[model samples]
Target: QYLCAIRPKDGRLVLSTMVYADEVNASDDIAELKAVSETELPDKELKMARQLVDSLAGDFDAERYTDTHRQKIMALIERKADGDTGLVEAPEAEAAGEVVDLMAALEASVAAAKDARKRHPTGVDEGEGEGEATTPEKAVRKKKSA
Candidate 1:
């Protein structure tokens, strides 16, 4: 029901009642109704407002989005089920070439040795055994095993 409060002086419209259509367009004046004081809202108006809020709360269609990984997996599964035995071809093997540069090889070896020393600082290099004596003392003397 449309309402109008007429001014007594010149019979002009002072206030108009709030409107709510069955299906409100995206660009409607819902802001005016929102500004209305909670105490001033009639029970019917409050109910309608609650209904409108509830209607707008959830409207997303989750089915519209596709999971690409899942789709690919499903396709592979279906292919396997139907015995689609086509395998993707592997690349042709090419002839292996030597490194060819001596200085570059030495640099790489030095770098690797430095990295190994960094990994184990006090560790023995190459031929040194823990229980074995040093070679310097045995240089001038020969030992007889008992």
Candidate 2:
């Protein structure tokens, strides 16, 4: 529903993302992924996965997120226009193929999301009105003035 272009095909609605498929590259990235049917997965694993997703139901709304990346870019442009000489340093490169603890990460995320929900039950962030969902101070840090 979020996609701009959608068309009806054989009584089913499908997203028309491109006008032409000439530039499309249907390579290994697409071919490598295979959907595992419910029958293929063990019942216990399927049930646990479903339960985990159910627990995170309230935390995964698309509307709750703001485009922080775009906002940062816009802010940088404004800073440049205002004659601010600060150099926008490139972010440090991360280690290639770092293994992560998925379960621990998920648990931490759940805890943080639940805490945020408790703080704001309506899902509307506190500082969203001024074109940001987070505090301006947190978004751009400056040196303390004596």
Could you give me the TM-score of model 2 versus the true structure?
A: 0.28
How would you encode candidate 1's per-residue C-alpha lDDT over 68-129 as one tens digit per residue? 65667789789988999987456698979876899998999998986685456354445666
lDDT of each: 0.51, 0.54
Best by lDDT: 2
Tens-place lDDT digits, model 2, residues 38-113: 1366679757766764564332233444556667999999999999998889999987997899999999998898
Q: Where in model 2 is the C-alpha error above 4 Å? A: 1-12, 16-63, 98-146
Each prediction's RMSD to truth: 26.2, 25.0
Q: Give one clash count per candidate, in the order shown.
A: 0, 0
Candidate 1, residue 109: the lDDT equals: 99
| Model 2 poorest ten-residue lDDT run | 30-39
For candidate 1, the per-residue lDDT at 90 reads 65
